[model samples]
Target: MHDEIARLARHVAPRRATRVASAGELAQPVLVVGSTLPVGQLEVIFRRPEVGSVAVQDDAAPTRTGIVTRAGLAAALTGRLGYGRAVLERRPTGAVADWSPLVVEQGTALADVAALAMARTAERRYDDVLVSGPAAWGAASTADVMRAVVAELAERSTHDPLTLLPGRSATWYALRHRCSLVRGGATRVVLVLLDVRDMSRLNAEHGQDAGDAVLAELAARIGAALPAGCEVGRVEGDGFAVLATLPAMDDIQAAASADALRQHVLAHLAAPSDGFDPAAWPALHSAAAWSVAGAADADELVAQAERRLRRERRAAVLV
Candidate 1:
């Protein structure tokens, strides 16, 4: 995961940095200037002691003519002024469709940025202040870069290259988040830790490419098979973490559903084209599911699941 993130960061860092430089040019200088009168100077006037916004205009631009905040101005300047435009044009950022936030695109509108800020603020408790002007708006470029960097750094710091899934950091964060969510009235959360059996042997048998193919196959299969409202992330090169809240059912219904899901997954893995070889795949499996509605969170659940898996691995004498 570290390697994959580093590779992606290398690809995105240049573009992100350029955007940052552009935003800095617009907002930093304005914060240095203060609200005065200019058709195009856009400055932040003090509305509050520590909080303020900016306004700027692009009269000679090739497009629309109007006043906008420092935040909106970043997009405006990029659209009109042309300093950090290239970077924002190149990389846009947002959420993961089925999994995680992957990229940031340029055409993402000011309205969209504002909406995102609002959503993040509501969900994660953050302030969303819009600043106007080239300088104030320019600062948004830096914000984008920082967000990209955090996502990129998180990937680099905690993900496996072969599978492109969460590594240790992601797993830890997921566990922690699930625990928090559980405390907030979540009913049922399942903790699953999966270890590929005889992975090293397969790698040795088929060579590195074959090993990579196996890992990739597992990654793809799990991703495809993840249940609704469940988030499955890679925990290590050879292991995965699954956090999910299964709906409550009667004893028979619950057992049948769990069994069916397990069977379906096993069947999927057993198929030749599905990716992994059933013949050499690991046999020992450990599963533990518990209700979190009665508990504080998923921390203990995660610990129990990990402990169970470790015991199974030991019993199998897996090295």
Candidate 2:
């Protein structure tokens, strides 16, 4: 089992980094100028393409002293005698300069960035966050922060954090799609729910860490055994669900396909691992239900499978 998992991991492609750090790579140039620059100079800088806000740096200060936005500059310049006047002379130092801007280090996590950005938005502040570090110095705009946040959320919604397989929502969507294909008279779709027996007992006897390791190993084994075009997801703790589209065939052929998948998973999971007694190898029990595309929705099909699963469990207990 360990060898099989290692082989699968080697063949699996590396996952892309989903942090806010990647968003920095997409950062664009921001406007920055010296505090001594005149109002006319600042006006010209604002006119430049894609320049939104300018960071004002004082010669005596190591960091940015303030920010001058295009709107603030226009307001400050109203009724001014000449464009050559110093910005400070027209609007005063504090009047035109925003003292607060979102600032972050280079390696800030994407999720953290998203949280900060959302807080700022809630307060009706739309200023860009400044990112500073080695090889990174730029402003992350509200758009950039929101984009990263949305991407991170979408990923989290669809994938299980521990197993990295599709979560409940994604699994339901996959089953719905497969059912649609079946309804189009293309092929048969089968939904199979598998439960790991005694998983909770194992966790209680050992620890959560051991249980997590077991779950991860089980996920890998199931993924490796699934046929191409089959979708598998971690539906709940100690339980997995598979949506498979069988070849154009009758009920017997479709049932055969589901049985084959169940056998493959059970066989692989029965293998022993280090530190685990061979007699304690995890046992799996599965129940499958067939569906035609237009006959039932995803929820209905899942309910049918669950009923079958309950019946089987009851029969086992009775025996």
Candidate 3:
């Protein structure tokens, strides 16, 4: 079992891995011009859609003498504040300017970037970080770092660790929300429950690795077969559910559409991947039940679907 688990770990998709954003990926464009250029040009530079900040180049030096931001430009426009005054009062001091950006190499981990961003935020400085790579510099803002962190956390919480599908909680929430919409007379919903027959027996005979492979493959096939707006989720061990919003139609049409979707999923699951032995592949059974907007609550719809699924599974076993 340990060997099988280790093999499954290596073979399963790495959907849970945290993604790192490179400095180059996060950088925005900066306006670079001579420091002596007219203050009027600052307005023009700020007007450019791509310019987020301006770098003033010294005539004699290879690097910028000061950086100008939109806020500095606004301050300059309101009064007779000259470029030199803006540089002295608004821009970072030479020492601070040198350290403000906190340059890092490309492909730095997002957590490291977030740490740097948090440090800067603590100091009340919102300067963009410069990412150095073989080609050019890229910029990363504190907001960007925070957004990545939030997205990573959300994915980990809402997705199944194994199948990478929506987990039970998210699935329940989606179904509940859809049921609410149906109750409002806005739409009809169909809930289809699918079960894998003899899944435990298959694991006992072929090992857990095969069982994992089957579940993963089943997830992929169901995702592919689902209609554009339908939601598929891993609701339990060896069980899956789909929440689909049916078009405005009579009960007969809605049932037909739901059955068609169920058959589509069953067809895909029946065709085992080339890697699996056909004789060892698990059988899939599905049952679908639909409710009009006002017919049932989310839990009731789920219960109805499960009852149908059990009936189908029993019939399949008896046959």
Best by TM-score: 3
lDDT of 1 by residue, 113-138 (tens): 44455455332212222233532232
How many clashes does the backbone of model 1 have? 27
Best by lDDT: 3
Q: Count the backbone clashes (under 3 Å) in each candidate.
A: 27, 3, 4
Model 3 scores a C-alpha lDDT of: 0.68
Model 1 earns a TM-score of 0.48
lDDT by residue (1-319, candidate 3, tens digit) is: 2221112111112234455455556666555566556665556667776666655556557554455556545654565655554443433223123223466677777667778767765543565566665654456666776777777678879988789898999998988877666675635777889978889899999899888988888898888876556778999998999877765667776677777777777877877788888877888878988886456488888888988888887898798
lDDT of 2: 0.68
Give one digit per residue, the lDDT tens place, for model 2 in 1-319.
3222222111122234655444365455566666666666567777876887777766567465567766566666763665524534433344466667676776677667667767874533656666665653577676777777777777787899999888988888878876665575636667889987778788887777878888887788787876555667999888899776655556665566656665666776778667765644677778888765336467787998999889978887787
Report lDDT (Cα) of residue 173, candidate 2: 81
Candidate 1 residue 132 Cα shift, in angstroms, is 26
User: Which of the predicted structures, 1 or 3, would earn the higher TM-score when compared with the native?
Assistant: 3
lDDT of each: 0.47, 0.68, 0.68
Ranking by TM-score: 3, 2, 1
Ten residues in sequence with the least summed lDDT for candidate 3: 4-13
The segments of candidate 3 whose C-alpha lies over 4 angstroms from its true place after superposition are: 1-26, 29-44, 47-50, 54-96, 184-186, 277-280
